[model samples]
Target chain A: MPKKIGSKTLLLTSSPSIIGYAAVGAKKEKQGPLADYFDYLSEDSSFGEKTWEKAETLMQKKAIELALQKCSVQKTDVDFLFAGDLLNQCIGSAYASRDMAMPFFGLYGACSTMSESLCLAAMFVDGQLANRCVAATSSHFCSAERQFRFPLEYGGQRTPTSQWTVTGSGACVVAPSKQAPYLRAVTVGTVADLGITDINNMGAAMAPAAAQTLCQFFSDTSTRPEDYDLILTGDLGFVGSRLLERMMQAEGYPMAKLHNDCGLMIYDRVKQDVHAGGSGCGCAASVLCSFILPQIACQRLKNVLFMATGALMSPTSNQQGESIPGIAHLLHISAFPNEKEAK
Target chain B: MTKQEYALWAQQESPKSKGLGDILRAFLFGGLICVIGQLLIFFFENRGAGEMAPVFASACLVVLSAILTGINIYDNIAKYAGAGTLVPITGFANSMVSAAMEFKTEGFILGLGAKMFIIAGPVIVYGVSASVIYGIILFLLG
Candidate 1:
């Protein structure tokens, strides 16, 4: 039987273990706060490829390779590969997975792809569908900018609300082994559109979705801010993070102590000059693999709630002046309560 | 907070507004592009290309922009220089090449060919039509 909790939450009975994680970032991401945490940093944004799109594909491939290497797992051992990216038709994942030679499930949740991939991967393992699977995602600033907003030479001015797309890739190996942190539960949120139309302000557009998912997760689990060691949002940046806090406070949920945004954490806002902060599929993916997962491995962060948010806006939709819809998928990761402790 | 209050708070938390430095940078880079164009024209004209100098110079500028867009240098320039890059013909070339590059993964005929004119298609259509209409008017007037 499926372990479906209230409305959108899923309490995974068979806790899937995150056996290993690998992170790779482009030039700008390498110069950020979590630079040291990344497994590899490419000096060349092209990743030795001529085009940005190809570079993103190489990045996803490299992330999966490195993660598999970390866990000493062979390609044949992995039952399935779950991957996605911000490219058109999710070419990054398809191209990467093609070379990987594994059964693949290509996904597209825009920036929320990390959590989405993880949520689905966890479900597969929890239901005894797979013994091992790899979840990976990538995003390139150049690729996303050209595809979504404006061409590099357009010289179009970016508003203050605009965020820099992060160029990075992150991958993780999920196994049935109890050697690492386990994914306890998942909360998949509904699409939220609060009538936000401005493409320059994705934080404002995605903030509502983050807030709703957080509220639903808390209410379903009957937990408080004290429950989790940290509650991290994917790439909401400064504006969306603060908006989420305010929305939670209105519901009497104090999130000040355990909340952080990966967008804001990636760069130094004033010094780096990343308006708002880093954002993209890679934004949360890189941060999780580079920073959060390592901290959890060391027992520094215990019970954590990670909410990856995505602003589902295509060029056609933006051109049609449709309101941007946001979606957030959350997962609960715990490093403690080891096999010994549980026994 | 109420909806209005939340909106106001979010706005307040936005990044720093554009400063005078941004305008100055944009102006400098924009002027630099024009200067490059002028220099190319001068070089070509001095080489005995005469009236064809301006044409070669513009073609060269567009080619340069397209290449830079490929190497990803034009984006950094646009980031700091802002709209200065877009005002020139080089910007249009960048759009075409970038669209082609982005959609190439979809397939050659459908992806690259279809999206190739996403930004420039309208301009070419209107440009040709307008020139033809002007020519007709001139002929009638004459």
Candidate 2:
């Protein structure tokens, strides 16, 4: 029997499918809206005028709106908003959240931002500190590329390990002490430095960081890989995820069964020629908010561990040649069978 | 003096006083940085470090550059790379250390404390200022 004392429960919930979330973005396309900004970006011009920050701002706002709409929660209903993105000084999150008027907190975890925000938001809900929480994270390739690497005009070759910055945003809402449909357990992440620092290719740079954090989370929580129906690592796409598994095996903590990397799952690797899969904070967030949440609603999965990994280096840090550090936070969302509904 | 004048002075002085030795030292140290980065990449690749190898190698390069910056070796390297070394991440580290050292004679607060944020100043200011403005707009609109 599962341990049950108080009637309070934490559950991970979202729209019916990941594609449903993608449909929100697709709607913008269907409207035949002029996305001239994106078009202007790919064209040859001076990079700064491309207005990447503006794009990041818009995407994040839209994501927040969708997540709120799905949760049946209004902006005013949320007590606080925790958000993050890869732009300079987290402009994407801060600027976007500014209008929402919820107490805003900006965060960064490279690709693993969603997990970080979720873990923090869940803690607030579980502790009864807040009644409602909203979290969002995003990454835009155009914005991140211009800030971190060469200008858009300077077409440089990206290596296989380099993950294309996801053109997406993910947002989630969690409510407090609500008996069901609430946050369950959360595992705060620790800095896991595998001493990797190649900025040109982040998957490898961040893989060891993700692996170390995942192993630590399991150890701390006293949970095994089989404890959950699925164990997902945020963004250790094709190469990094494989490397992470190998490292885990070497350490005698393998996760071969029911384990998937969100990075690889988000995009069609073969069609996209994405050697690895999707990455960025959006990769994990979109996967969870879109795909995993729907599965939970369907009662297809019971216990799930969402481990989001982040490369903690910034453009300034990378430029300064500081060693890239990484962090990952594991959040547990258990979907108990609704007794009434089951009957 | 302008940065140009300083360059001219160094050029003139080097020719008379052990110029060759200083030239050799700069070249040797500068070459050493590149070699170290290359060697790290090779070693990790050979050991099957795969994706992580580059991150680690780049990290090592940064650390090595930092130490060299401390000893004033990286300045010589800058002469060769011009802006190449400065443009990369390692160059940022050099700038931090170099700025800190320049102000070292002043007290820590006035020197290092004030100077640490020098290189990173613009980005931070822009980030915070933009957020504040955006926040105001959001408040008005929402």
Candidate 3:
């Protein structure tokens, strides 16, 4: 008889190191992204190097600490650490983890880092490789956009279908057994590109990928939208989420009633004035960590399909006029088994 | 189409055909965009993102409205709050993204590259054109 795959626990979580956000009153450089907004940087300091690195490192340290605190597990108890971030050469993550002093298996899934890390950590724990482990992903809005697209100094208008970069981070822990918090199922995705090329606005560009991945997840799990309490999309924002819903419906799989984008949940719509919703790796990661996890811990909701989507296209590819390629990873997170099951 | 026909088409295509409900909705949506932009101005200023708040916020509002429009929220809002959604940066964002998406299927080379100029194209053109005229006037005056 097959052993039942019981509840997998959430041991801890963390996000990409964070950079000091762009000041609100900065001047707009004639050709920079925020050159006109030059006055927003704090009086303490405007923009600088190492800020990104600093953000990434601090977040990682916090994640490790949080995991230790919540799970009451030692750094040494975590047999492996799976992490990723939107930094050149994964330097932010690798460098951050180096200080934590844990065995590391660094990954790169762009915005899909959360699911990537979670999936791997779940496998290790499920296989009984280790009693406890952690999975996490992090991103900084300024650092990501600067590296991927235009410099922060470049000032230009944005398209409506564009996604705002979220300036936050997220991290989470995973462990084997149906203890307290757990990962239920995971679905890896295939590549999907409707061949959109406008890199500046990622919502439209990555919508097809989100649609493809969600549809595939449903197929792989043979489940429908109602199967889970919430079909949480990682960062497909407003436009992408709509398109994903529409495409799924067109493809004979609709998710109209139960779908939400993490980017959409972060900022208050009336207050933030962010249009077309938020994006970036941190958008989903932060929403999951700060908002979603808290809700899950409180038992306000159950069975979350955390599908982190990504734009796999590089800047070189965009500059080359190639269609944007997209990917997604689906992680099924649920409450841990009851007291009886744990025993 | 003849010039006369084209002019008629333009007249018909103008975003002003709806009734008072539509107009009010647009105005309200537009005002909401402005309000959001204002709040962003304050938010970023507090956070010290910079004085570029208005410019960035305006641009972001346009894009946001455009996204809402693409998702059909802007339209529904416009239907009730008409120019409310149509007059702000959100409107601008809606215009650009919708146009870009329309032309995306044309293939990257001619479609995406060429169509990028569709919405922002006029802005670039008029911006450069106005700047050129302004330069000439300044040159003559100076």
Candidate 4:
């Protein structure tokens, strides 16, 4: 059973292992640095689908299938599926899981959905309520752009702080089996709004939430930043990343050397012309499943802290002049299931 | 730190626009677009377009904008061009065409037809209303 470590962190004693994982990306992602890590890459941003929304769904479905296939696990073996995306009503996850015929829990944590879903899945497995579960999330550039910002072909300039929404999907299968990379603990974050109202600067909006979560996790675990091999943030990109580092420094947890952001890792900012960096649910999701997990599995990385941050505001909220609230969910992953060894 | 303090710090920490460089690009590209319009007006006038030269040139620009938008090149140009592309007749046409193309998947009536003017709708409403106000003021002054 999962034990409450402190006020915010949940220590999963059972230590659910992510036995299978896969990442699927579109054209822009294919051109990025982590292209080779992705399980599947589609040149067409639409994934050969007529609509961008449908393409997002298809990309998510492919990721789920690839994950299951890699682990030699059948769909029937999975007890539950937790998924979400950036689309309205989480249609991306819903349509993706439609044909799966598994019990589905649709979540909405914005870009932080990958870790949010993973935390829930791990909790369910740790409690022995389910033998196995799948956590998945997806986001597409065109679909998000039309719904949140503007029409795809609209002639408008993106600001320096604006981030490109990544067209990608990532999935992971969590089970009680003893795997190399284990889910050790999870810190569910509270919403932190620093009163940032600029819709173009999501990184700034989400950075406060990430700092809050990381500080809380460190306090709860009685561990410092040096304890982990890497402290990975979801989609804070360049602006948010710098803000987070400064915040962490102020909080006396200077982790400049150990910290990295999925948004920054996914794309080459200079070459890709993606001003600030990449920002999407898929940005962290794909990076975790494809790049981070494999390194952990190979024993290259021993202890890691993965936290995905999200801006919990809709177009309506932003348009209504409401400040963007941000949330971040943290997962402490280790190469071994043994608690003492991890510590 | 307090929320107010953090907000101020974050705002300062975030990157700012390129300032003068961006302004220069906007000026150059915007001027280039106007030069193209002037050239088209000249060509139409040479063909005896007379007072219709400006209208024909505008139509040509709109059509060219629509084509660029269809081929998915206008956005890339606009990214560097900034206000250069946005503050023009071509930008207005691109707005309508892009919205129509995007919402087409939702269907014609509710999607393409209705939302075709989603971006340009507000501009049209205020533009026409202001014109009516200006006409009334002109009549009173005369």
Candidate 5:
């Protein structure tokens, strides 16, 4: 095993290559700022499914199918699948995986499930336990609304601090290969809470966790802000993104350039009515698959630290007056020139 | 740091609402909604509804609001108009229309019927009780 850099980060001894990835977003997402980044946008939010839940299931299925197809790996060839969604029992992922028929590990890291699955997949591939593993996660605006906030039928007035849940899915494959773009390291974050109660203002609830994990990652690796080409964070919407910067600036780090948020990237703040920005696990997941991965693949960027942040709260927990807790997972994704012919 | 202290710092660090622009938009759009309602009342009176003109006008207003919501116009207006769209009776119609539009999927019965009262339920409950309590007080005073 590679020597541990810090308290939370693990430097992978055998860095596993991210072989394939796919992103599927809904119509509203197509109209967003990163419209060109997605692999496909459903003509309708339903994607020809009868219900929002079923539609989400289809989206997850499409993402996984396309990701594996890109790597020339069939459903039968996939050793295991790691997947999750913002749904009761993660039904969207479960229903989709039942068809793939691979041994599955259902994860629940809330919005951070994408990175959690990716980290676990890298572990499996790096350990030689699996030659290839598929990681996927999905979220839908309607499904998340009904489950978390209020039924859309409620016509709940969104506060300015509220973020729009992104309707999308993202999937990728991790494999044992000596390749250019690979998972070099990972940092699993601890759950941090500031006792934030406003469900609409997830940005504030989640920012502290993001800041703590970030401080931990920097301290452990002894890395400066200049080391990474891009330091991307997941789902810290407009408010949280700025708040995180302020919180970190006080920590004695100058983080103006090279910092971006997937939530901010997923939607247009001015034109779109999404108050804060696009959120949900799908926001970061889809952006990583469609936009960030391509950047690495084309060598437009060399090194990036992708941190997927999540607010780990449940309907029961929130309803019962429990404070929202947040977590963030980090992956050190870097690229070098391919020695072999690039695929 | 203590949770409350951290919470206060977090809240301060959080973004504040652009109240001035929002208030102006809300006022202008709210005035526009009132103007439309008055126009409907005039139209109903011109048709000889006389004593019942306001009742007909209210019905027309509700229908107009539902249609606006159906074609996705109301939400666009509500996005900017803020309390202006919310203060009008049209907003009540919007709540019902939005509910049906959102819950139309679960086969119309359990989905639509069950969820249809999300906003109206609270509004109706308080409205009825308040009126009943006021009625008793007025009756006793008289």
Candidate 6:
């Protein structure tokens, strides 16, 4: 059974473990600093597909397949699949799960899709609604570029604040098992809009939501920043991460020492020429699957707060002059199920 | 903090563009593009196509822009060159050609044909409308 914590947080008594996970990345991500962490890296961004959209679908499927294979979990054994991407209508996850024949829940949380899906999947497993579930998300640089910004070959200058959408996919299978890394709790965030309207500065738009969520979790659980080994936010990039640190400091959390963003961890900004590091759903997803999970699994990190922030605005919304609204979903993952409670 | 206060703080925290450096690069690259156009015009004039030199040069530039876009080199140049690449005739051709190449995946009639002018459509619309207004005013003055 799941226990309700203060306000927005939920503590999972079952502590569903992420039994298997995998990350797949394309050329740009391969060139990144965390390149060696990826399960599979392809020099071809298209992934042998005719179109970028189709390539995204294939990449997502490959990630899920790799995750399942890692745990020797057959496709028929999984109970539910939660997946999404940055594509319109979540066609990436839709088409990716089409041939799998699993009970699918399609989600759209922009860059926060990974955490959103993972939180829900963990909840379902915690409540015993499903025996095993898979959470997955993907994003492609080419597909996202054409849809959100300009064409791939369009001659336009990118602002320094603009983030490069990572071309990658990440998938994980969560089940009720005594695995080393376990899902302890989760916090669902409220939308925060501070009248930020700049389309290029997503970090600025999302930082508020991340601060709100992290603050809420800290207050709810009566925990301090020193309690967690790492406080990781998804794809806030350089600008958002700094803003989040300042906001957290103002709230008395002072998490600068403990905090690290998935965006900054995924790329070497200076060497990769990624102006504000990486963004998109895959940025957090791949980093979590490859780098963070492995650390927790090996007991190197005892406790972690993984919160992924998302800017919830479409191209139409931006063009219509609507301000960007941001949301963040958080999961408290730990190496032991009842370690904090015992402490 | 209040939204207004946070916005102000964020504005100050964000990095600003290097104004002088960007302007200098833009000037240099933009001037270089004009030089290429002049060379094309001279080449056409030397071939004795005096009346059609400008037209031939523009066509050659457009074709060169399309080729550069196809080879995936124009955007990289534009990144550093900034407005230098965008203010020239090649930029216009790049915009149209890039859109055409991107949307071609959807289909021919709806995707390529319709979206081919998506980026440059406003420029064409306003340009022709302004020209018509100018012509009307010129006739009235005469």
Candidate topping DockQ:
6
Task: Determine the TM-score of chain B of model 4.
Answer: 0.96
For candidate 1, the TM-score is 0.83
Best by lDDT: 4
**Per-residue accuracy of model 2 over B1-142 as CA lDDT, tens digit each:** 2334423432332213235654565456546667777898889999999988889888887786678788767765564444456555576566666666645544699867796556546756887999999999999999
| Candidate with the larger DockQ of 3 and 4 | 4
Off by over 4 Å in 4: A341-343
Q: Candidate 1, which CAPRI tier?
A: acceptable
lDDT per residue for candidate 6 within B56-119, as digits (tens), equals 9989988999999999999999989999999899999999999999999989999999999989
- Displacement of residue A289 (Cα, Å) in model 6 is 0.2
Per-residue alpha-carbon lDDT of candidate 2 for residues A81-119, written as tens digits (9 for 90 to 100): 888988778998988987898998888777778987877
TM-score-superior candidate, 1 or 4? 4
RMSD of every candidate to native, in Å, equals 4.1, 19.5, 15.1, 1.2, 3.2, 1.2
Please provide, for model 3 over A1-343, each residue's C-alpha lDDT reduced to its tens digit, 9 standing for 90 to 100.
Answer: 1122222222222211111111121111112232232212222212333455555555555555665565567777767888888888887678778878789998888887877777777666666676666776666655675567532322233444556666545555665433434565666666766656767556655666666666666665566777677888887776677667766777787777788987677655335545666676656766676556655555576667788888887877887889777778777666544323323
> What TM-score fits each model?
0.83, 0.60, 0.61, 0.98, 0.90, 0.98
Q: Candidate 1, residues B1-142: lDDT per residue as tens digits? A: 3456656766777766568887787688889999999999999999999999999999999999999888877767777777678768877887788777767766899988998788788888999999999999999999
lDDT, candidate 1, A253-313, per-residue tens: 9897789999999888778888789899999999999999988877788888999999998
lDDT of 5 by residue, A1-343 (tens): 4447768888877878899999999999999877788888987999998889999999999999999988899888889899999998999999999889899999999999899999889878877789889999999998898788754533235788899999999999999766656888888889999889888888888888888888888899888778779988889898788778877788876675878999999888878878889899899899999899989877787888888889998878988999999999888887852223323
Question: CA shift at A86, candidate 4, in angstroms?
Answer: 0.7
How many steric clashes does model 6 contain?
A: 0
- Residue A76's C-alpha lDDT in candidate 6? 94
True contacts kept of 5: 0.36
**Model 4 scores what on Cα lDDT?**
0.94
Which ranges of candidate 3 are over 4 A from the true structure? A1-50, A336-343, B1-142
Q: Report, for every candidate in turn, its global Cα lDDT versus the true structure.
A: 0.86, 0.63, 0.61, 0.94, 0.85, 0.94
Standalone chain B TM-score for every prediction:
0.79, 0.52, 0.65, 0.96, 0.93, 0.93
DockQ of each: 0.37, 0.02, 0.03, 0.83, 0.37, 0.84
Off by over 4 Å in 5: A1-5, A150-157, A336-343, B45-50
